[model samples]
Target chain A: GAGVSQSPSNKVTEKGKDVELRCDPISGHTALYWYRQSLGQGLEFLIYFQGNSAPDKSGLPSDRFSAERTGGSVSTLTIQRTQQEDSAVYLCASSLFPRGPNEQFFGPGTRLTVL
Target chain B: QQPVQSPQAVILREGEDAVINCSSSKALYSVHWYRQKHGEAPVFLMILLKGGEQMRHEKISASFNEKKQQSSLYLTASQLSYSGTYFCGTEGFSGAGSYQLTFGKGTKLSVIP
Candidate 1:
């Protein structure tokens, strides 16, 4: 892909359901990141991956929130027992540098609505 | 901590100019700017490093003052295509600590023709 791409531009789910969001980063990029933004709120860092190393999962909000990156390319974020408060836009970004303090390219984002 | 952005929102006629401010309590080493249209992901604009550096892209411009941990975004002679939400993302340092940004809530701008 030319840029970072995420699946399902929008997802609407019941409060008790689980949802999975996928991200396929641009080829050759070594760093990936996930973030969530509630309505009118600043972005919240969720996770980060650098190549094949153990992902930096420090930002995951709760036990119900988890993510994994396989093959150093595609990643998935899963949220279980979705709460209304979980409704937000989930964004994925990728960068070319391993030690990326560099610019990141973003995906269109997946807007999740928990009803 | 989240960066502080002023005015929350703004409206302007095409060709007008506007400024958005972002402030942080912690010392900043770098700042980035992004713009997002409704229902879309943010697009990277420009970055200013710890030292004074002004960066511009087309009609959009930004400045960062590391000492004060503040940044300003300028939309000069705005166009209808410029209508969007602008965000200021602040970072504390370049190494060890994550370079990930702490973003402002955003400033919504409407460029009316």
Candidate 2:
């Protein structure tokens, strides 16, 4: 089976520009999540989508960050007016369900660099 | 809140045992463990629920202490393949129905033959 996949493994953008990162979750996965890994830092939760319920955006650092999952499979994270601080690896993951001991399968991630 | 991982890094020799710990300031419902090699996605190791249930995966095992809000990953007879960064994700109640995980700064483990 294909694991979670991310597009444009690397991206470079200028400050104040907008960038979008895409993720394709595993088949039949009902839950999807987004996270960011900064240099020498841990993964920070960004957003979550479970089935058709409202997505959780609590982890989004600022208003410039947002995400949407369509058809319960593909998710896109958009950062408006990118800042140098946004330079990090954006990761996507998926699982069978919303809660429980389910392990989230991660993607290779997109390394974004803002100059 | 993000959990705290002890010993940011560790080095071990084959056949030796090692322990990695994750502690949270707030009560936790479950803890998830993962291992990732350079330039690869994180691979799931195991998950320990709040009931004090201990789970094992091959040579790896984990224990969750609900009272202390801590989890420990135990690796027996470490192998060179075990070299990677280990991350612990924690889930807690936030008054909302949804559950999201907060990950800790990973612990890098290097095992040599």
Candidate 3:
């Protein structure tokens, strides 16, 4: 089976620009999550989408960060007015369910660099 | 809050054993373990629920101590392939029936042959 995948494995952009990172979760997985990993740091939860319920945007660092899962399978994370602080690896994960004991499958991630 | 991982980094011989620990300040619903090699995606190792269950995958095992709000990952006879950063993700109940994982800083394990 195909694992979770992200597009544009690498992205380098100027500050104040907007960048959109895409994620394709595993088929049939109802739970999707977006995370960010800064250099030598742990994974930081950004947002979550479970089935048709409202997405959890609590982890979004600022108003400029947003995400939407379309048709419950693909998710796009958009960072408006990117800054140097936004340079990090963006990871996407999916699980079979939302609230139970389930393992999340991760994608290769998109390395975004804001200059 | 995010969990805290101990021994930020460790080095072991191929035949040695190692243990990584994760602790949280808040009550935990589950603890998830993952290993990530450099420049690659993180791979799930195991998950332990709130019941304080222990799980094993190959020579890798984990124990969740619900009462203590902590978890430990045990790797026996460490192989070179085990050289990677191990992370513990903690999940707890938020408001509105929401749940998400908060990962620790991670433990970097280097298994030398």
Candidate 4:
């Protein structure tokens, strides 16, 4: 893909149901990021991955959230046992490693609805 | 850590100027600016590195002061297309491959012509 792509642009599920979001970064991007934006809120950082570097999971709000980037290319964010408060737009972004300084290219994002 | 954003929201007429501020509690390595319109993803504006230097991207510009851990985005002669939420992503530390982006609450800007 020419840019970062996400699957299932929108998802609706009942509380307690699990959801998996996928992200395919740009072909050569080595750093991927996952963020969540609630209604009328700013982008919340969830996790980040960089080639050869241990993934940073500090930004994740809770243990129910987990993510993994395979071969520094593709990544997935899994939210377990969703709750009504979990509804938000999940955004994925990629960049060529923020070496000295660089910008992140973001995807359109997936809107998750928890009933 | 979350930075505090001021002027929660702003409404401006085309060609007017606006300022959005992001203040962090922790020391900042750099501050990044991004614009996100309704229903769309964020678009990078520019990043202000340490040393109080300013970074400019087109008509949008930003400045960061490592000492105060604060950043501000300046929009001069705004256009209707400039209406959107502006965010500041701050990096606390920088060294051997340490990069993490912490965004502020955001300021919603509505430009009315």
Residues B50-112 of candidate 3 have per-residue lDDT tens digits of: 875699989999999998999999999999999999999998987756666799989999998
How would you encode candidate 1's per-residue C-alpha lDDT over A13-36 as one tens digit per residue? Answer: 999999999999999989888999
lDDT scores in order: 0.86, 0.90, 0.92, 0.85
What CAPRI-style quality would you assign to candidate 3? medium
Cα distance off (Å), candidate 4, residue B34: 0.4
iRMS (Å) per candidate: 2.1, 1.3, 1.4, 2.3
CA RMSD of each candidate after superposition: 1.8, 1.2, 1.1, 2.1
The parts of candidate 2 lying over 4 Å away from their true place are none
Instruction: Report the TM-score of candidate 3, chain A only.
Output: 0.96
Mark the 10 consecutive residues where model 2 chain B has the least summed lDDT. B93-102
Off-target runs (Cα >4 Å) in candidate 1 are B93-96
Badly placed stretches (over 4 Å) of model 3 are: none
> How far does residue B66 in candidate 3 sit from its true spot (Å)?
1.3
> Could you give the fnat of all candidates in order?
0.57, 0.75, 0.75, 0.64
How high is the lDDT of residue B81 in model 3?
96
Please list all clashing residue pairs in model 1, or write none if there are none: none
Model 2 pairs whose backbones collide: none
Could you give candidate 3's per-residue lDDT for residues A28-82 as a string of tens digits?
9999989999977899989888874545788899999989888889999999999
Which lDDT value does model 4 have at A50?
Answer: 80
